[model samples]
Target chain A: MNDGARLAAADRSARVRHADRAARFVADAGQTDWHDAVLWRIRGKRDAAAGRVEGWERLRALASEIKEHTLSRLDEYLAAFEEAATANGAQVHWAADADAHNRIVRDVLRARGVRRVVKSKSMLTEECGLNPYLEARGFEVVDTDLGERIVQLREEPPSHLVAPAIHVRKEEIAALFHEKLGTPADADDPRLLAAAMREDLRARFLAADAAITGVNFAVASTGALVLVTNEGNADLGAHLAPAHIACMGIEKLIPKPEHLGVFLRLLARSATGQPLSVYTSYFCRPPPGRELHIVLVDNGRSRRLAQPDFRAALKCIRCGACLNTCPVYRRSGGHSYGATPSGPIGAILAPGMDMKRYASLPFASSLCGSCSDVCPVKIDIHAQLHRWRQVAAREGYVAWPKRWGMRVAGWIVRSPRRYRLAGRLARAWLRHAPRRLRYGSWNAWGRARELPRVPDRSFGEWYAAERGKK
Target chain B: MKVGLFAPCYIDQFYPQAAVATLELLERLGCDVAYPRGQTCCGQPMANAGCAPAAEAAHRHVAACFEGFDYVVGPSGSCVLHLREHVEGAPDARYYELCQFLVEVLQVERLDAAFACRVGLHASCHGLRGLRLARASERQEPPFDYVAYLLDMVDGVERVPLDRPDECCGFGGMFAIEEEAVSVRMGADRLADHLRQRVEVITGTDMSCLMHLEGLIRRRNLPLRVLHVAEILNGSGEARNG
Candidate 1:
């Protein structure tokens, strides 16, 4: 296969083995606890900030409704966006899939004789493997976001959406910078490390020929692209370069410019607990003497939009609130997901992209519904996870052991007579079996938890006796 | 009210005291309670494992068992929610998790019950989010917990403050075995939260969660004990004879 296809296959394989990667991450108890604490703090901040809003739930409802309306008539909005963008002096490109998206990005860069590009944090590019695609085709691509830059320097994919290099410690970042950027060997301060990155990236930004950014919301009516970031990297990159490329999924459309108010009110508060991002840049028209291109990608999104049970997932605004609020993501770390958008949202979205590859993603959640609760668009995340599990099981993606085990369990619980017999046998075994036999390797539940004490009489038996007395 | 006491599978087999408490508690509240002999499981285990077809018979069995009762009440919120969501032909509105039934249906303002101990309330997920018995901690709504409200009316009962209120205990039916490592870690973390409060007892609406937490507590030989909300609300505190 081609280089891009080969890389995509390798990435899928890596994600398919999420269980092993997650186990290794969780093995480091101290790091896992630190990660959990950090993410939980973000969740707490989100809660406190969201609580202060007078009509937060109403805003979420309105946002959900707007997304639903837009998605139902996506073709119309896409046309309107393209028309308005063209009218506003911008070119529009539609990519059917990730490969096509990569090829389009390359063609755009090549036509402009661009050799260097600076990117502001765009998960769309990550999903499309645009960086590697461009790099293999002989173009220098620099990720300008602080967290993205850290991970890019390390030649690793981002671990979190809001904080891409959240898994890396300050000391590790210091070491990476020391090795790559010629910083002092013992430099461990955040300010110093950030300063070193800023100095190095400032040079790249000035010399870059093209700037690419991910669109947070693509307003169809005004033909404007909303880009939210704490760092002013998108502004610097998009303006300083001769060509600007803004990439967005087809589901990122809102019908009118006014609809942005509801989303803007919820996005930053849900993401990082800020009332608004430090920089909420709107790119309606390209800068003077610069070319503007909008690449609207529909890589497995149209298929997802047609699924009635899963259509709500498209309403995601990339707030990353669900990740912060997710217990599994906090403990296991983002890399455990082995996908671009890791955590609860990824679990739902990834399986739709490739079911056999991401079958384990849905099972990663405890289904506590915290992700759904904190979702600004009111996506029923946990319910969707449940639906995906059922789909996976039906499609025979579930392993043989689990499949037979659940089938056997289903049989036992269906009939009262067999149910009583199984309970009796289980209790008898627990009562008489030695500790070693009970807690052996074969028993997964017994590894960390003790067996419940077997009562001498079942509640059924006790209730029967109570009836006799009555 | 004629109440059908729907004992979930785990409570029927492993946690009989919780069921006994539910029975006696409902009786004390002046209801004629019936223990339907044909009732076995709520079909949640199968359905949650993504084998809903396997749970079909159990759903039919449960719906048939509780058909004639004026109201079907269960000690576990998780099972009640499963019935409401998954069971076809089942009376969704007639079925209630214990605390919800007492507070909403019975309009129980006070109970002649007493439990003299500081207990940490473990809010199980299905009850909190699915059943809406309590406002989830993640939401912006005004705080309300039917379980805690009922516990407050019982004399000599004090609730200890938890570090993270309303976190899942991680006993997600088949999830306890399917994803053992993460499940145990979550439960252990929850236990530590309660232990820090120096609680003598931890009580919740779901016994499945309690059983998992109790297993960890028992294995470590911790001083804490697990009790269903029914046992605390029942107030007898008498040890069951095996």
Candidate 2:
């Protein structure tokens, strides 16, 4: 590994690894959405100038209430959604895990006697591993979203929730396109690559027999689904396909469309600094005789809801704003999440699926609270992440070194004398210490950066000395 | 009033000047300051590393050291934030982050110091986010303006801003070393943004971040200097340091 890789790998097993990963949501997030954030800042400045836009805060409040009310009665709405969806002749399957979710999606495609399917940006599909499962099952799956298609062509995963292929620079994407489609075109100009992808995917979007897309918000009030996309690919995928399959976690349900305004106001503003996204499209009830499937996959969400504290995580709108604002996410990038939906929201949700599987995610924050501040509906992502760390510790999902380290620390903290003794010892240790202390992970941290030198006299000693004179 | 001046270990050693400024600032603000010398670390290194247990001793040492002081104030926000959040018994111990102590407790309106330059406010994540001295994110009503309020008081200072205000510089103690690339990238990004605004100097409460940025600033031979907000507020002006 290169120095950077070796250093990052050294941190892979640290207690703050999750915190480290979450901090960079900004740098790593919206790599594709760079265009999006600039757009939003422009929109934000303009909106600021536009005097008062009525129903903005009220809309977020209403959206928050809708989500709140929906989650409060989640069982009822989910049941209603399943009932309406099944009655409308759409197959509804529940998957407990990503494996199961992927299997169900693959099975749906096979059952329809379809071999090829086109897709838009859906975090659920990425989380469920659906495309690979289908591809592995001898079916072709084409990504319709320009970003998703670029990542698909490159055999990579989407880096951001909204913009899947964010990590690939346009030049690299141009090369990917150059390799995939004999379009020996210059890839550096994003406009050129996007236009090239649009041309190539337009044919696939038309020929694809089925389309699998992620539902942005599923309305229980009318069994209608909403999707907000900058690329407008979801609309195209749903519009052209004979079979439209919407994959969503159980938590996206809100009672009414009126409530979407609240989340919509905050979502685009926080995610991209846009006053609102370019399009917020809703699809309620399929056109007569079309096959529409809504897979209400649990994928550990039900289990998260089973616990009162974590169910709010399901309230996510998938704007990736939290990721964009996170310092950890900005630095580490998304691939380290090891699963889809990497970022602040991803850190909290990943722990639920397998606390150990994604144990390191909770430490992804500097505890900056930017994610919570930026969150449209106001999810306390950092707090939830801390709770996850406690849970992971309780669940025996700690590294041996950290556990022992904490155990030793726990003994010292609650006991004052031991704490003082420890300090004196450390001071003495530092007094004669060489340039470095090459023990454990400190070696790695002390390499690029030197530890702050310990003082000979503790603050308490100075206090005592000065206090005695007084 | 008797105040326990929490000189962060770093301040007590490498950056004694900040501690001295803090001590003088406290005294000028009308309080007898006591240096709690027995205190070494706030145990933040442990708590942040998810080894709060290990921090227990450090916490006990600090708490016991400052047990008698009517209030505790520190020049460093990271340390004071640690005192406020992670430090044992700090919540009830009448603790104040340095700027907070100046603005709220000591309640100093006019300071005997001035620097006539474009000052970029580097809100250390601890002071900016942890003690939440200024940030309210989005839900916060009208946003509590603490840091800006204090900086505005500085004479002839133009508070140059960054594109993403309140974003982290990625100096998460261990993080800078572990994810060195991302950490360095984040620091460089923040530094570049500050430079982009053409601020003559960058200042914040946490010297750790400032020190990291200072290293980068020196490496690039940038004209800008990094100063602790405490030093700036105390009128201890910064000159170019090699």
Which lDDT tens digits does candidate 1 get at residues A380-440? 9999989898998999988888788878988887788998999899889989988899899
Best candidate, lDDT-wise? 1
Measured with C-alpha atoms, the lDDT of residue B63 in candidate 2 is: 79
- Classified by CAPRI criteria, candidate 2 counts as acceptable
Instruction: Give lDDT tens digits, candidate 1, residues B1-242.
Output: 89999999889999888889999999998999999887888887777777778788888888888888999999988889889987887657899999999988999988888888888999988899999899998889989999999999878788887989988777777777766777777888898898888998888998889899998998788888888889888985534211
Model 1 chain A worst lDDT run, 10 consecutive residues: A1-10
Residue A77 error for model 1, in Å? 0.9
Which segments of candidate 1 are over 4 A away from where they belong?
A1-11, B238-242
Candidate 2 local lDDT, A425-460, one digit each (tens): 766775666654533455544433344455666545
- The DockQ values of the predictions, listed in order, are 0.70, 0.28
Share of true Cα-Cα contacts across chains kept by each model: 0.60, 0.25
Chain B structural similarity as TM-score, candidate 1: 0.96
